[model samples]
Target chain A: MTALAPAASPARTPLGSSIARTLRLGVLRAGYEIRVYFRQADAIFFTFLFPVLLFGIFSVAFSGQGNIGTAPDGSGGISQGAYYLPGMAAAGILLSGVQNLGVDIANERSDGTLKRLAGTPLPVVSYFLGKMGQVLVTGILQLALLIVIARVAFGVELPTDPAKWLTFAWVFLLGIGTSAVLGIAISRLPRRGKSATAVIIPIVLVLQFISGVYLSFTMLPVWLQDVANVFPLAWLAKGMRSVFLPESFASAEAGGAWQLGTVAVVLLLWLVVGIVVSRFTFRWIRKDS
Target chain B: MNNIALPDAVVSVRDLAKRYGAFEALRGVSFDIHRGETFALLGPNGAGKSTTIEILEGYRDRSSGAASVLGTDPQSGGLEWKSRLGIVLQSTGEQGDVTVRDQLAHFASLYPNPRGVDETIAAVGLADKARTRIRALSGGQRRRVDVALGIIGRPELLFLDEPTTGFDPEARQQFWSLVHQLKAEGTTILLTTHYLDEAAQLSDRAAVIAGGELVAIGAIDEIGGAEARVPLVRWTEGGTRHTERTRTPAGTVASLSARLGAEPTDLEIYRPSLEDIYLDLVRENAEAAAAEIDADGPTSPTTRPSATDPITEGASA
Candidate 1:
């Protein structure tokens, strides 16, 4: 061979095949990421175990108590244990999908992992898809684990109706999408690895409080409700409650309805905003923009 | 060499330029890497070595001029074109807690024809540490992991950007051996390094870039002109040291002894090292650029000497 060229060129797949190839490769990336996450005790604790612990605490503290907020005048309010089942589930999804995902990406950015991956022939979109896939899988598992704990430990009743499950499915999917997108978008906010927790924890805590995950929306002030309405967390928590709470609990909600259409619209808006913001601000390297 | 009139050039560039607003990162840089050749782009920080390499790697866009890698313009080179090349960045940024084998396998799936994960791990001398999480490995071993990933694709063209920057002397030697093995397998490598010794050891041809322009481009042994390959004559007289650069150092030493009518004290003749010539080239290029900026006004574009111009008169006195 001469000095410049290789004796044989690398094999190339056609453009049509690239998407299929990238998706297949993306699965492998997802598997690698999942395995790494499982091996880290800290990642597991925050993503899986912490949500279960929070669910137990809330369920016991609020057990058998009547809902304190805006239930319809004639109907008795739902028990606090039943009210918080979806609240903790929503918490788990947001914890893994938004807070954890954002911090993980920020750490990757600070450490140059993203830059190294960009250097390879790996389709750039596939890397993001893989990360989302990991969050999706972990978020679902966290939700399931919390549901089991809420049922077995606190004796909470699950919604058995097909219609209720349909609502749960849509709300869960949209919540994960909105939170994952938000995670990817806001990951760039933390300038360093050490500051990722500092930036993410406060935002999550505030979102949890204002969004009705910690306190029922009826208990919150109207001004705070307006502020929470602007963010995905409140809509997600409200949607989750609509799925798990008894139909009578709709009396406690605004407008005395589940507000499914508004939930879909609000969550969809957050998803779109996240995708747009991240497209412009995401960086592979640590260098200043 | 200035013409780069090669029939089988794998990478070819002509007057490539990149601009960021008012600042120019590369200005009229030109060169070619012939088939199967290990080429080095040697320069200091911000000398535009990385910018030139990044443009060739299709990671950044050039503001103007012609450039091609693997017979396609890097700006539009598709995934098919990209699959043929591999890159090892200056930093080893990998997913922590992943085993060496796992990371290599994941990258292998991105390529149509990749080396076996086990073989690649062995190739990088990480066989003993293959199962260990990357976070558990020492810094040098992690760098080996970076090299493994770069080659896992069995790429025709490999780019190593300052691959040995943080390596200890032994680790650096091990890396050099790995590169030599890749060369033996006919992999064409384009390496960028500020270490002249690294360029001298690994590259068949090297281009010295300074101030975003090519100062010299030729075979490593022949760059900076042939006279620069000469030896230095040294002597001490009256407890003072003196040295002279000359092509005929033996004759110069003989004349010095004859004139002094006594053996020059502590005399030694040594060949001018590639590092010496490289440093001289960089210093001269910086001065030339500084002078042009002063004469042409500070905001005027910096002018470069002709591509064919020798870096200096040479090491010869």
Candidate 2:
């Protein structure tokens, strides 16, 4: 028998196999996150349905009086159902995208999942993209349910015009994307502190109240209204109002437009800020600080 | 086994070092692993065992060194090189309560020509748990999953870092046998472990790393493995004790047989196991640290005694 085997041809790595590897990596991340969300359905239940539930309580308590005592556009007593619908949508979007993505990503990075993914052929960017992909899929589904609940249960009028629907769709997706980035950016700031929700709660509440989602901008002290106008929450509330409410109900002023554009711009800025900070942050192991 | 003769070297290293900030985890660590054989890398926690294995596996970069694995620089090797390499990292996350068979099948899809999932599961002796959800599996079962993933690729060079850490005694023995089966299939294994018995059982050759340096390397039996050190002998002489150290234990037993005119009462001959020598080496390492001392290098006669193990040294993995 021969001591050494004869030479053989050089091996070729199959192209199909490499593609399979990369796709599998993405699939693993997305699948695991979905499973995690399902496992923690109670938390998810509060995240999605609680915002709509809260809207039901507040809309009727202040119904028929109009959110604004003084209509800047001079439309008299616009329906409370109309005004609050858009604001609630914005609040729902923020509650779902920012709170969910920010907290989950932080916890994933902390737990060895991100570190494990760091070694795979999957670039860290792919993991975030997969997360984005999952969030978008869930957001659309959540929005559909919210719209049905509003139109059918709460007797809130939704836009039936096709052009208005297209506008609604674009702005809705954009708002989701924008706020998602801001949430991610915000998530980066509290890296060392491990209790993700503990840190995010105060920030979410402060923005929600001060941005005038709970109280109408028209009735807010002029100073508070102006301050709200300068933040993304104000923009989200105003832009969303323009979508679901009658045009006459919107503040016929620069501030309403400022509300939408500023939230978009600030969220985009936070997105950039988040990306930069995450690059510098040392992701701790998943279980501990 | 095939009639193939091993080459001079499959792995070659010179002055390998890795540092994390102020700590030098591996200081000028160096050793060679030969072709078609098992080489154990042994050390305690924080002894740079993981760092060295990671570098060899191309998962981490080294601070400084000229180290070649399977003839390619571990630092710069590409997919062409990586295709021939396999790595089982220390821990893998649960793939969300997936069935063991399904997860193995999914991972098997990544390799161009992977071993069948069923066969791999059987090899790791997880046939009983094939249908079990991965989340329900014990730590040892999870490790079996890790090993299944690693070898699914049929890599020529395999890196097993702490592969049997959570394994039960029976599972550990089965794992050792599975390793031998892989060797029969010509997969060169680089193993790191805290268990000396595993090193003695699985490795044809072994290396010990501590404080970022290669303390010793050679055939497992001679590289300060149990065989290099003399066996301890003791007997009762009229209620008093007697003792001696020698390389020949059975011969010592023969002498005792002749002297006592039968087996001597209370005769006990203790052969040095890999654990005994390993403890001595690690202890010697600790003492050397305390005394601020550096011992003689590879020139130490005991280290290079005789490379007479059947597994050949070589330039292939």
Candidate 3:
């Protein structure tokens, strides 16, 4: 038998010193997750790069000189290219944080990665927080890439006011919180690692089309508009539009307004509901059901 | 450090049972693993060995009774208590894309004090594969990675569930040595495997569990009983073979030789192997179950036996 060198004995410390330990361990776990996420070409392409590509496609297709919608000033027409910027940005956030996050969580649970971590001394909350931290980092990068594509390719104006940026920040945070929490909550439905994509992608695609990620919300039928309004995705798109679009586009919205209060309330409610449901529904490992 | 006296038991389980609705996975199983000892829980598939270990590891909840690991109840074991325990699961519980070194380093940070990541990689014989993605490694290499993660925490108690299932023979040898090194350093280990020879080779004591109950448990040689430890004598007489288990095998063989007026033809003496005892014990448990069903009516709800008796017979060749 080949013998390897023995490990040096670790110095003893009091047990359960988790306040400091949690932060240190959470950082390490987050770093590990980020490294692995970047290394997987498939994860990068589908979660981040796919959104950038979509941004380019949507911006170029809508860049025609023709004016198609009511301008923010209630003028006869608005630039179609400008109309798509926030829409694609909303889709990007939903794909990376909600849809992709669900698939990742499902894969991890079925693959026993979550189970292994559950057996360790690390806190369970730390595991989720660390993973969410990685998702937030990636989500920011994905959003940045989309914004860059919009400004460069479509001549979309950047938000000039600091208040608009503040609005953008809160909307982004609440949108990500709601979607990522829902992502974790929804992962309980997929029993197998391979089926996560099968279950999540189609739903994301349908939601994207219906909620105006692929087209203007006004183009959808009235019933579809009502259905879209009930879900957080539609409100996310509306919220993002409020941050990027001028004030007159509010008339195109369902209530003829951005409904910023409703956006915050609805997203916050979803976030809270997602957390509660996930606490009850999440399984560390597969069950026979 | 060489001769520090350790606790009487690092793991103490008593009357532990787990029930999933009406189906009972563990039926009041009990065992103890003293500090610095390699203990094996030997059983067949679905024998509740995994259930028992998992309960002790705090990965699953138990229905009744008590389990203590590192002097704390595993059910509510705090992080400090958890840090002292290492669990090597049967499945590959790692990201497929992470490099070996990175994975080990990440797990190392979870514990308060941990073995160096590079050293752990070498200890598990994964130095060559340290930079390889887990998905790119072979089955045996992944198993090594599992062990590396299990031991990186410098746990006082380690739980390994079928740790060598996919290992090649050489890798298995290396793993055995790694376990031995851990034992020499006074790490208490509780292992479960279907391999009887592994139990005999590595464990100071072993418990044979079958049908969610412990059929027998003791020192490897003396598990079945004193008679099982004794040798059996066999001889051929007039084209027929006769065999008898006896504590006084020497006297029995001498008397048989004298009666035959020479060495008996095809004379042989052998002690019952651990496998022999284990298989006999399992068979006895099954027969006992069948007998209980017979004694009780088919419609009887209490056909499951409340207690199992270990059979003393060791006729296995």
Candidate 4:
């Protein structure tokens, strides 16, 4: 058989001309990621269903317990269901964003998935975009599930004003974005797939406990409040609370206000931190090299 | 070692070396793979085969060396450069829940030009299992999936690292035929294996590596030099056994029979196979290493024999 030289067509193809094609491939990768994610029974149960289950249990247990606590303005206390609604929704974002990506990316790195993809034409940006897209879509579905159950079963009142809805939209977007980036950053901490959950779960669990997801923020001591304020989770939960609770309820927060400005700034800051950390941490192969 | 890159060489390496702390994995090894040629790197376990391929694949960086794959330095190769090479890693843990077809289709989308999903599946002999989840497949079947992904990109140079490690004989035959098909289609392949028969059957040229160094490199029939392949004549005479290495076994046997005035008892002629030459090369390298240690003022008796133990153990089975 006659021999042929290596094909020269794609060798000199400039990166500038392939941006659109890379984006298309990224979208295609997202479709594949979502399909595979849904097929896993364990992933669906832990990521999507866990938060909804928590909402059900909390609302049912505290059904007739009256208000969670009284407001300073004497306008009346916030209902137990309404107060926990936003907290659980925020937790949903954390689950789908940080927890999901941390373990998933670690597994990919250890399993040769990242190495195989690295050898291909797929850009690293496209890989991250696929992950971010999965988190965005799954995070939205999870939030909707929590919100629907809260409103229908527990008779909780969601805000009707367009301004409040706008607040919810931006808060949700920023929260998931920061969470996705942080997830990728922390994925490098695990040395192998089996230890990924052991390494990541403790961190996520500690954040949920201290960040006002499981308990009332004002009830937490001042020291714990200060610690939680340093992280993005606290800001994310507070942002969600502002969207669902009455404006007067800001008096109950640690700062004695909703602090939407600081919430935006802190979450934006953490997003930058996550980006910087991941730029140095993410690798196509294991660290043995 | 030749440092100049051949005009049509798809892969060229010169004085390539890798060090893991104080341990040297590859010690200044060099080779060239010409366009559309099937080149095999044959070695015992941990003889730097995978290390060399990983460096060429850009999965690992060499400690000190020069490597050119597809006419580009692998360390700086970009997406355009990566798109032209196919890599089948030694072992991989790919997504198990996805169907074979879905997995192939997704990977196919990342290439500028890729083989059709169904076509690739059929080419790897997995047509019936296209809809099957990867986790449900057997070990050999999963290996085929790995091959399917590697070739789906239509790479100009394909790296197959111990590709048929888990395949049965029939499956290996099928795999070889598939490789032959790729060769016929002008796909350059670089393969590493412990199977001498595989190297003899599939590669136009082969290199034998021992203890992180290449000892012999040439065409399949010419490796280890003609001296290593000389015919051996052995026979028993007067309650003593004698053996001679000769170029013409027939003439030697005739001379021996005429001198003895009858056919020598239990006369036999043996021509060394590829495996015999490989074992001889590895043994010679080990002896040289042992002699070097002796000249350095012998440290221990215990460590000397261990150097040659692996060669004997590997050759036994």
Candidate 5:
């Protein structure tokens, strides 16, 4: 038998070009991540489809209720389906980006997946990029499902104006990006995989309730609106409402206007917060080291 | 105790120590594994074998002391350095969603120079299960996947931590042949295993650790020193059994037969196997620890010798 030959030395790529390599690996990792994610029945039901189900339920239950808020032209208000559409879409982004990613990371950490990856040459930044890409894809699909159910199933009118669509795009991007960063930051809170759901669900649920996803922001007590103003989800939902609701409905907001500039500023601030927190908290291995 | 780092050594660990709060998982330990040599780290459970391997793999930070793998300190080893080493951890929690081939392919892409995925799969004896999802594979089959991932990178130095833990006898033989092939390719291997026979078969040199310290480090057959490998002559004399450890078993038996002994009853000569030498070294270390504890104070009860303390009694005899 012929003896095996020694391995040849690896080709050295310059450091300046490593960023491009990292991005390429990150995209490749995202493909595998998406494939694995779709195979899990629970992830599909909870993270991707749960918002659609909630929208369907809320639309049917509130179908007979009169128009929501009056328009500036003295025309009739929009239907209940149109009113709750933005909120549910905002919630979908939060579910896919924050809750799903947080628990998924905790499981990977406890199950030795992170430990194995740490031993490899794959950069940690590339890994995070993979998670962000997964969240972006899943979040977009979730938003589409919500909008389709609202328009086709419940006869809710979607925004057709280019300016409104532009607003929708920025809100969607900033909301999911900030949420994804926060998800990585809080993944370290749960000590084990079994406890990840218990720890993350309550936090996400509480945010949904307080941030105008489950309840109208203006309908809540003045103090509660003040509290909701502190977080990003409130701004995300308000931004979505600006796209779907008529101009007069903006008067119903706590600030008496959509305040699109404030929405952008608040989400940007939270994105920064997530980045700083995750920088300090994220670890390749557990805290035992 | 020599602090001089060998120039050709692929792994040089000197005065390494790791502590987890009050518990010291690894005391000061030192060893060097040269290129193309299969070195075994043998120890019982919780004996710092995994800890040392983890530190070398850069998965865990060392508490103190020096560790240089592939000529770079593991704590600061960059991606270029990491690409050259293969690590098979003691246990990993790989997701079972992907097919074995898919999993191996993704990992192969991460390396600058990688072996063919199908060739690696065949080497691990999992060709038939390539299309199968990893979760559906049997325990032994899943372990082969771990080995496949470890070698797909064409690592110059491969760290196999208990790689054969769940393998059946036949599968273990196949794995041994695969490891031999890797060694033939001039890969420096550091293996940790509970199987003494496996170590004796594969490793050129070995180090035994106990109580977080290196007890013996030398050539596989020469571990525990020549003094520990003496032959024993045992026979039943009158109504009692006697065992004598000697350098020359034939001469000892000859003298005994001439002294009122016609071939003796149940006469047998026993050569100390690697297992025997290993057990003796661990037991001696344990007894020395017990003695030190006793010397410190009389608060704890003394450890009583077992009835089958044959090594101690035979050596005294």
Candidate 6:
């Protein structure tokens, strides 16, 4: 008998190889994205830590003097501290979803890194999934930080109800999905990305404010408040406040505080829109402007 | 054409065309690169080299014609085919904040049959600097990293676009040896470079491209073949300098010995090197460009056709 040459046990067909390739690429990309966040100390410091700090300052500066559940019996609505928690959490987490994902992706595309991977076996989904994965991690961290500050430092009421925790998770995930897709859509618009942070920062701040991140949605012009409801931030804040505050205190403008069905529909729509726009308009690798 | 029984033509580009609006970058350019051969694509700047490479790399779509790489059309072959080919671009690939070893290892996993990361690092002469972050490496070291990544997959067909742009003399020789190793492994290589000396040293066959068209292609020895071209001998005899051209330099030296009744002083044979042929080709390419311009000669301010006139790439390739 002739001796046989040992070979690489020929790859398990095209389908199996493709699946393995996709998984490996995705994991590596996800790891790199988290590493990028760690390396950019300032981005982590600014995007996450500062927003929680800002919440703490405002929550402490205005202590007590207001009630929860029924809009303080019209006694100045509620304590500034209690009132700001939901908004602050929404704002902080939204920054992770939008500002970081949108601008950095645009910058990467322009820098030719995105194009460099085009020839590699790395699936396109893996890279974007990596971004979303990073955002999710940061979002979870931001959520924990916000809760810790609200409880330990500000001494604000923590929602003890099982339902409230469920609400928070759903709302938080929705907010992340909506904000991420919005960022991706924004990234697709071929604007001059050289001064990316400069443009994205102000826009992020403005959107947060418009969505009642800083001021109450009720205080805003009714037209603006109505428009804000169309976004994930408004729904997230509404859902968060519903859990923190009792149903009676829920604002009518928030469409009866937490309409779970409405929140679900809006989130789903945002998810669909995000996917469609990212698929077509999101120039993940190219830009003329 | 010669009926060359190719071992599965690795790169078969048939009338590949790319038209960017009014600017036609490539017009029906055609070439075939056989497997297990170092085929050099020689061209001047803006000679459609990049556009051609980009199309072949599956990064850009050709406007027309077919281009197949590794038996699959690059435009259509999705992920599986890409993993089999290695491409070293003229530009450096992206670097993240990681050691060179880690980066190579990570990329190695992306391919089915990747070489060991440590071995690849040694192959690229980066064993000493394996732990260094890419940002810390010099321009030459960084270029080496690009080459390492290109070969980590043990690709069957490797495209090296100016792979030795920043190599020192010693490093260039080292790189030549490494490329020889790759070639020995039966990796069909397609390299584009302006360096004629590098091409002559490495390539078995060469194809010179100009004006978006292949000007010449043949074996490196037979290319612009030089053999029939007379050798020029220069020397000083009897304290007087003299130079003469002859078909047979040996015969010239013999005649000189007989005439002087002694050995000619400072006698040196000067067969035209590949450098001479390359420069002459570049000059001729330039002259052709000038002549084309003179003929077309912009009779109007713009090349935009009037309502009655239409512009075309003059018949076709």
User: Of the candidates shown, which would achieve the greatest DockQ relative to the real structure?
Assistant: 3
Worst 10 residues of 1 chain A by lDDT: A1-10
DockQ of each: 0.29, 0.13, 0.43, 0.39, 0.38, 0.29
User: Once model 2 is optimally superposed onto the true structure by TM-score, how far is the C-alpha of residue B203 displaced, in angstroms?
Assistant: 1.9
lDDT of 3 by residue, A1-289 (tens): 3354554554555546567767766777777778778987888998888877877776567666566565577666556667777887788788877787789988887678887877788876576667777778888988887887677877777879999899999999889877877888888777677899999998888998999888789789999988988888898998899988887678878778999999898888888998898767775654321
A1-289 in candidate 4: lDDT tens per residue? Answer: 1122234343433334677876887798788788878988878998889989998888878867867656566457667888888889899999898999999998888777887898898888788888889999999998998888888988888899999999999999999999999999999888778899999989998999999998988889999999999999999999999999888788878879999999999999999999889877677766244
Tens digit per residue, CA lDDT, model 5, B1-317: 23345889999999899766555667889999999999999887767787788788886678898999988888888988888889887756666899999999999988877888888888898888999999899888888899888888888899999999889999999999999999888889999999999999999999998877899999999999999888999999878999999998999989998996487999999988888989998898888867877797744333223222112112112
lDDT of 6 by residue, A165-268 (tens): 88888888877877777777777543445677777888778778888777777778889987887777777776677767655566554555467778778877
lDDT of 1 by residue, B1-317 (tens): 23344678889999998765555768899888988899999877778888788788776778888888878888777777777789887664545688888888888888777777887787666888878989888887887788788888877899998888668887777788778878877788999987889889999999998888899999989999987778888889888999898988788988999999998899999987789888899999888877888888866754433332111111010
Q: Give me the chain B TM-score of candidate 3.
A: 0.87
Interface RMSD of 3: 9.5
Task: Decide which is better by TM-score, 1 or 6.
Answer: 6
Measured over the true interface residues after superposition, the C-alpha RMSD of each candidate is 11.1, 11.8, 9.5, 8.4, 10.4, 9.6
Tell me the tens digit of each residue's lDDT in model 1 across A91-173: 88888778887899888876768766666667766777777788888888888888887778777778899998898888988
lDDT of each: 0.79, 0.67, 0.79, 0.84, 0.85, 0.73
Evaluate model 6 with DockQ and give the value: 0.29
Label model 5 with its docking quality class: acceptable
Error of 4 at B113 (Å): 1.4
Poorest 10 consecutive residues by lDDT, candidate 2 chain A: A1-10
What TM-score fits each model? 0.85, 0.78, 0.87, 0.91, 0.91, 0.86
lDDT by residue (tens digit), candidate 5, A43-84: 999999998999888878887776776557656888888888
Worst 10 residues of 3 chain B by lDDT: B308-317
User: TM-score of chain B, per candidate?
Assistant: 0.89, 0.82, 0.87, 0.88, 0.89, 0.84
Cα-based RMSD of the predictions, in order? 6.5, 8.4, 6.1, 4.8, 6.0, 6.1
lDDT of 2 by residue, B1-317 (tens): 11121354566766777654444667887677778888998876767787677677665666777778777777666555665667787775534456788777765654555677788888888888898877788888888888887777677778898899889898898888888877876778999888888889888999887555677778888987544477888888788988888877789879788988876778898877888887778788867764553365544322312222111001011
Q: Per-residue alpha-carbon lDDT of model 3 for B197-291, expressed as tens digits? A: 88888899999888889989898777988766678899899999999989888899889988889879999998888988899888898888677
